[model samples]
Target: MASTTTVPALKADRPLLGIAFMLAAGLLFTLLDTAVKWLTQSYSPVQVVWARYAGHMLVLGGYLLILGWPRCREIMASVESLPGQFVRGLLLLAASTFAFLAFRELPLLQVYVINFSSPLLVTLLAIPLLSERVTAARGIAVAVGFVGVVIAVGPVDWRAQPAALLPFGMALCFALYQLATRRFGRNDHPLASLFYAGLAGALVSSLVVPFFWSPVALGDTPLFLLVGTLGAISQLGLIMAMRCAPASLVSPFLYLQIVWATVSGYLVFGDVPLLETYLGAVLIIGAGIFLATRKR
Candidate 1:
């Protein structure tokens, strides 16, 4: 009986561990975004994106080399679901490009809040796209989340510049990208999808980089490399988290990234959002958590 009880307890801990991993992955990704924004002040957004993908490829390639060609080939060839993979990759590329633009124009936390709307969008999209039933709880969650977004937008000062639209576009594209990822998840190995995504992003960015390429300073090279490596690690951790838990359960944990971003923004840039921003963030997070806890 003691062994049985211990086993159940251990099983219970697994989901918590998965949540922790998801949170860490989100934090890493947020850091990567912040770093890119910093770099963009001195380099082109395309240049930073290219460096990120190039670095990702190098890290993945090194890992594959250590793991051996056979395993690498197996993973790459595991792409039985090529069409879905390609679609997901295309959507991701669009999302990444827009996100880079958003980072260039907006504060980190503001950009993050806008992007956080993706989960709610995904929830709504899943209904029509996946033909999943939308329950009352989900409807309420979605409504509340949107309300939070409205609150967050209250202090934006949009008339000063219309570039704010970039982040909203980024959010929409990212939402679609996540939806595509769900479709791909039904058929492909997570690592396999990631490998292909890295390949696609690298190739696309490489082509664009040459047109906009500016010489990098020695000091900046290390930062670029760090951004790429962290991005790769974050992707890996996100895959693991998704594999270990249901999307809904893991999805809510992403909002914790806002907490990380808030602290980082304060420390790194002396940025402080308005009270409405915090209130909105809390509402959106609470709504997401409510949705995550609802019984299907």
Candidate 2:
């Protein structure tokens, strides 16, 4: 999904830089997720969603102004792409909400393990939606990836831990979100798409976050604000990473987030992953890398 065709070839000549950017993005994202998980412990998921999107909007808006606001009007013009922005935002909102809900009850490792399947889902969806052909190797990779998901989730009763399903739902929503970005966002300025993503999420979430809003204590204000800041930074890192190197190189590095998530989960929450989680992560991540690196 990160391997969009629209990324300019001229900007992607530095694979090493892209790899570094991707690593940084992954780390920032892991931290952002950890913060969201912690905040969701006290506030509603919708409120956290609001912070994520709202902060993203503020940062991106500032950066756009700093860059001389190139194509500013075209980017803000809603007539051409309002519906696409709405759908993409709603899709991501669902994904983030599900992820936060899952984080409240599940270990970060477990949530990330299931969420990592989004790329695999994207490959499968591309076959039909993008008119792309799936060779046997790619097909096998997708199948093995889902098998790993089952291994990660185990055969536990859903009633006992229904939150376990939330990550899977997040992965699905995020996969569609990626697809929408590729399809509907191919022609727009990348910054515009980023800006609208933040705006759309903020707009939709604004409708609900107010009802669930809890006033932050003065001391905790910075911590709450950090959530959104980290989100914007992570997203900017992802864009820069892609610009620095070809998608194939930069995309696989996204798997590094699982390692960060595992470490962060252990240190912050005292949550240790089961041996099976390791085995499953190995399988899922291996398949995803194989699929990601394979020639399309």
**Runs in model 1 lying further than 4 Å from the true structure:** 1-18, 155-159
Model 1 TM-score on a 0 to 1 scale: 0.90
Error in Å for residue 26 of model 1? 1.1
Query: In candidate 1, which residue pairs get closer than 3 Å at backbone N, Cα or C atoms, i.e. clash?
Result: none
Task: Compare the candidates by TM-score and give the number of the best one.
Answer: 1
lDDT of 1 by residue, 198-225 (tens): 7878888888898988899999889999
Residue 137 lDDT, candidate 1, scale 0-100: 77
At residue 66, what lDDT does model 1 achieve? 94
lDDT of each: 0.76, 0.74
TM-score of each: 0.90, 0.85
lDDT of 2 by residue, 1-296 (tens): 33334322352267677678878988998999999888888878878888889888888888878767546775666334677766777887888889988888888878888887776777777666655567898789778978887787677678988787899899889777766665566455667667777788888889888898997768766767898889778765765665565443345566667799889998999988888887777878888678656765
